[model samples]
Target: MLKLLIAVIFFAILLSLAAGAGFLIRDQSPSTRLLTSLKTRILLTALLMVLLVYGFSQGALGT
Candidate 1:
């Protein structure tokens, strides 16, 4: 269940990144949406890293 949740969150972050790139290409000027996406991605990445570490420590990620 935890792994599934982590995968979903990671996929969402990737989708957000793709959307932000699309916005950057379509818009004439820089927008807050892109920055917001970037910040979100960064935060999500950090969270994911923590989750990975915790999972490893708990022996949930390795055989």
Candidate 2:
């Protein structure tokens, strides 16, 4: 359980870092910058949440 939580935390951090890189490194099209940023944030948040849920449900970790 502790391990799973740790893993999830690490994964979330990695995802956010990658998203930050994407925002920092890419030249987004003017038409899509705002949308892309919003999408990235949403996906990051959702991915973390899903990981948490799955880990907990699978008994890999306690919520």
Candidate 3:
């Protein structure tokens, strides 16, 4: 369980970093671009949360 949490956290951080890079390169003067960044964050966060929950529940975290 502990390891599962650790892996989940690490994965989340990596995903967040990738999204951050994409966000940084996006347009700087458009509200649509801003929304795109927000959308990416939300999607990644949700994906990580779901993956963590599923992994912990199924005891497949590190397998």
Sorted on TM-score, best first, the list reads 1, 3, 2
- For model 3, residues 1-63, the per-residue Cα lDDT tens digits are 656665776676677667767766874765465466567667767766787787779887755
Write candidate 1's Cα lDDT for 1-63 as tens digits. 779978988998899899889878887875688888888899888988998899889988879
The sequence of per-residue lDDT tens digits that candidate 2 reaches over residues 1-63 is 556665676676676667666766675655555456567667767766787777788887764
Relative to the true structure, candidate 2 reaches a TM of 0.47
Assess candidate 3 and give its lDDT: 0.68
* lDDT of candidates 1 onward, in order: 0.87, 0.67, 0.68
lDDT against true structure, model 2: 0.67
Pick out the ten consecutive residues of candidate 1 with the lowest summed lDDT.
Answer: 22-31
Weakest 10 consecutive residues, lDDT, candidate 2? 27-36
Which is the leading candidate under lDDT?
1
- Candidate 1's TM-score reads 0.89
